[model samples]
Target: MHRGREAPICTRMSHPLVFDRALLRARQARALALGPEPFLLERATEDLSERLLTVKRRFETAVDLGTPTDLLSRALAGHPGIGTLMRAAPLAAGLAASERTIVADEEALPFANGSLDLVVSALALQMVNDLPGAFAQVRRALKPDGLFLAALIGGGSLAELREAFAIAESETTGGVSPRVAPFADVRDMGGLLQRAGFALPVTDVDRVVVRYGSPFTLMNELRRMGAGNVLAERRRVPLRRATLLRAAEIYAERFSDADGRVRATFEIVWLSGWVPHESQQKPLRPGSAKMRLADALGTTEKPAGETP
Candidate 1:
């Protein structure tokens, strides 16, 4: 229990996880509505794998939690970053031959405690309902002094799109159901990691601005990349033609750069931490500091009560 807080335990990885299923379904539905494309999550996994292979050449054993499309496996086949390690699960056949064993949930990883030297998560953590529990699970899976790396969309992402829509809706009608979903702020995420008992937690932001010809074109790309927002208890009404047109006008007029292209912001928050190690210890010697009794009285003499 926390010292002064009465919030429910936010660190359980038990059965029937608490993620917003409606959100997931809504995202799925939105993706289907837009076009045929895999979610941005899969791409995140691939990018994470590539980064690990590129920088951390010393780490041989690594795991990618929620790996979709066997991205890590394929990356391992060639330059595979610097380490060039092989995937634990080999590809069998077909397009997904490189697909590794699928773990059911991130809240409870299958690996034994202290087994993994490194664990990487792509864009999947945002979808996790029980984020604290998920972090605890990651901590348990890591070896002593092991490392964990991850990337997730930050709160600052898509500010332009969100604001444009907000203003347009207020001007045209009363207000419309918000399209973009809320994301974790860097400070909140850092606190969650600390609460999960992760040590040396650090976060950095990656602001990616994607240019689009129009709001519909931007929506099309999001659908293709499967990056639509998913929120529980989602509003089901279709966006009216007027709303779309107004949104585009607002986007172009307000969010357009000097180049006259609409800019969509994506603030990717990257974080890394290491497992706390019991071995980093130091024993104190008894009576390490001597009492300079003579100097106490400013006369090179012990006080009357001194036993030395």
Candidate 2:
């Protein structure tokens, strides 16, 4: 049995690493759904759900994990991907004309065991402290041969930001600041799926290079995109002006391109797997062709029921 380290979450199981609230908050506030919540995190989550609906319609029966936004549900209702209308305009009109249902929450999915045909989540699983537990639950929620697909930021994400912070802190304070928590490695993620009883687990990575005039611009974009760091013991105060300057200088020295814009690398790890099923199981049949025990070893082939 694969026993993961106990995380500090106050529920059924804790994750090995502390989950970052900032990152969770950012995810929550995203535009998964529509509307302006005073909280940015809330809006982000809404946005996330909206985007997920686009993927959800692909499955025979799909369930989204996390909060859903009204705007997203509204958008989903009108999305032509569901085959609701022929023309885009007609689809938009039909969507605008219908009410939609959006379910929110991942930890406690609202589905019976082995009921889901497919499950897809985007950029959300890492935030869950008890990833193994979550994976187990997901496995149980899927039908035999059902598929699970997810996109998440991995350890290689934000390399430039991490490097800049590391260099600046080392030069200024002789210590590295803990502003961000590292993401899961590709190998680790694949193992997680397998350990959770998922079959044929596969993990692939996609590298994205984003350009920014300055580090601050990049940071601001990250914040807007709800992709900010969210380690549990992250620094509460803003970085000092001098420290920020040094960080920027370090970033330029190490990561700047000839075009004078800084490059930030994001590693998006795509994971996929299937739930195992008894119907797919195979057993060794009687009278099946078998390798001769002695002939392969240069000894005389044994007759039936005879020792070599």
Per-candidate count of clashing residue pairs (backbone under 3 Å): 3, 28
Compute the lDDT of residue 179 as modeled in candidate 1: 75
Per-residue lDDT for 1-308 in model 2, tens only? 01233322323664466766545654546522322332322343344445445543344455434422233233334344333211111121112333222333455544557656666565566666777887887787677877777766788888788888888888887777676667888889889999989987878877778788988888766655555566777677777787789998899888888989999887767788788877555566866848755756878765689865
What stretches of model 2 exceed 4 Å from their correct place?
A: 1-11, 26-59, 67-103, 279-308
Could you say which candidate leads in lDDT? 1
Q: Write the per-residue lDDT of candidate 1 for residues 16-65, one digit (tens) a residue.
A: 43346545545544554555444455555566655665554465456766
Model 2 TM-score, all chains together: 0.68
Residue 87's lDDT within candidate 1 is: 32
TM-scores for all candidates?
Answer: 0.70, 0.68
